[model samples]
Target: MQFYCSKAAAEALETTQKGKVKSWLEAAPVPEAAGPWAWQVHAIKLARQNVFIVMERETRFAMVFWGIKKGDGETLLKQFYERMVNLLLCMNQDVNWLNAADADVAIEQILQRNKRYCFVAGVDRSVQTHINEVARFCEGEVHEIGSLLMDADEAAGFDEAMNDTLRSVRGGDYFYPNAVFFCSWARQYAGASDELCLELEARFQRVRHERMAMRVAKHSDSSIPVYEQIMAVLQGKGLKP
Candidate 1:
């Protein structure tokens, strides 16, 4: 699927602090030489004084980095880049395995397989209008992913419950009642059955590999050990790694 940022987000990024602007200028020439998605950073330029634009050609996505002059643009770019990577990785399994040319072809195949389009928006009030307009233009559903956690007490309890369930299962203390309850819940939510769960379990490994590939691409030194161990396990299971 194509990715985009809200116009307001783009506008807000127009004039960042001086330090980041300077760094962008210095790094502009080698924009694709590094980063999480080295194949994606097509162009980085100072659109105007203190205003920088980052373009990702593969997805036709662009963002403006503006305001402030003190800190590096790492925080802003990291947040945006991670979200972009997540979307791309979720949409195409080959995102981590193939070369840029092959990866692009894989992404195209995925898009052809899934006809629906979706627009996701961050829950920032400043960009609501832009999000609405884009959603309208695409004639796609618009949704938010994270604001549900704003209910602090409910979120904390939910987290505790999930962790407790995982701990119990890991400790060989799986309770029949909880298992039945979760199975029923899954059936109601996604019509999951025993066979479907088994299928999903196998599919989970593939998804894990995709995520690991992203980590290896972005942080090879730290991610390689874990990746190697997981690959060995998958190989042991007679699965492709």
Candidate 2:
């Protein structure tokens, strides 16, 4: 989906308080290394400073939501929604066509009781670590997932925790894969055919590893734990020292 802010709105962004600008862009609490906003930066690279636009590839639609700076969170939120609604109207789309974060509870309660929209949340390491806290609220089938961006050690820890959580799940099937490696040898463990569950775990680990590598390469100067973890994964994967 694509959206563009009016020229006035784009200009307003520059005059918006630095704090407000940070919040609007969902910038971190502390400054991150350079180019962290590469995607967003690329979007606004040559645009008229007064226009804010978002384009979605799937729908080939551009949405223009106006940004306003205000000290009152409630008022700001109201205005934000109104701007979103106005944008939807201009595009000749229903207000329900928009996607936002975690407002599922309220939106589902009022607008689409039929549950037309399904939101799948991507759980990161921190959220995965507190599985119980998440599972308490996330009631549904869980596909055992992991990140491959971590080193074998970190991945191993994550694997164990995932298995534990899988065991404790209220209702659902657990699926994963088995390691074909036998220590330093290439022999598959005897009598241990890889389960679907084990395969899922391995898949998650690989994806996590790749994601970590990308992150590390993208922010080479950052000293964040994610960067360190990515480096560790690269070393473990024999892709780096």
Candidate 3:
């Protein structure tokens, strides 16, 4: 998530909005971190129905893109992701041209693009019997983008997501990776087939949506039941309602 800007970019940004531009640049993620990083991209409505979110899962840092037109699958994500990465490194309006980098796009070269940086294919979570969230821009094929972007564009939603991300990374949220939920489920289902394990994951997500509908007044990490469902399934018990 560390960023580096050219001397010119820094100089130009320093003057804009009395350093608001520079501060925003300093605060946003540049996406070059070596990562087992998680990402999710999907569309939402704003000034248009075409808004898309680009986010890093662990950091919960996000960017929103708008006025998109659907294109071929990989073409759509790569084009936008390339733009998103470049936008992060440069000023808001224009891309920086760095003679120092060996390639025309340093981060794209660094990330190795589809080989590692972006997901060209879709997982199409839309098929789940629960809710259908098609990445409408990806030609109805879907990838596992997030539920967060619907709310995260706002400061309150952004802070809440960032807080939950930090807490989850530190193992506070039971349903987060490496936390008690996943760890316990992994322990119980160590030898299970991949499909079976994925089913458990799906059920957890379903329960999460149901819980989110009943948003709590003192919101924090989702409570224990979401975690419990996975364990119950792995232990050969039926899923809980």
Score every model by TM-score: 0.23, 0.19, 0.29
Overall lDDT per candidate, in order of appearance: 0.35, 0.29, 0.36
Off by over 4 Å in 2: 1-23, 28-49, 65-80, 83-241
The candidate, 1 or 2, that scores higher on TM-score is 1
Q: How accurate is candidate 2 locally (lDDT)?
A: 0.29
Q: Write down the TM-score for model 1.
A: 0.23
Top TM-score model = 3
lDDT digits (tens) for residues 65-112 of candidate 3: 444443223443454455544433332111111343422344454355
Candidate RMSDs in order: 18.8, 21.1, 17.5
Q: Which segments of model 1 are wrong by more than 4 Å?
A: 1-166, 173-184, 221-229, 232-241
> Between candidates 2 and 3, which one is better according to lDDT?
3
lDDT of 1 by residue, 1-241 (tens): 2223334333433344654432222212232233222111211212222322333322123333333232334555554444333334432342133355654564454334334322222233322332233223222211234222323344333322332221122245433222233233234333457876454434544655676567655755664577686676558855565
Q: Which 10-residue window of candidate 1 scores lowest in summed lDDT?
A: 36-45
Worst 10 residues of 2 by lDDT: 34-43
Error of 1 at 30 (Å): 64
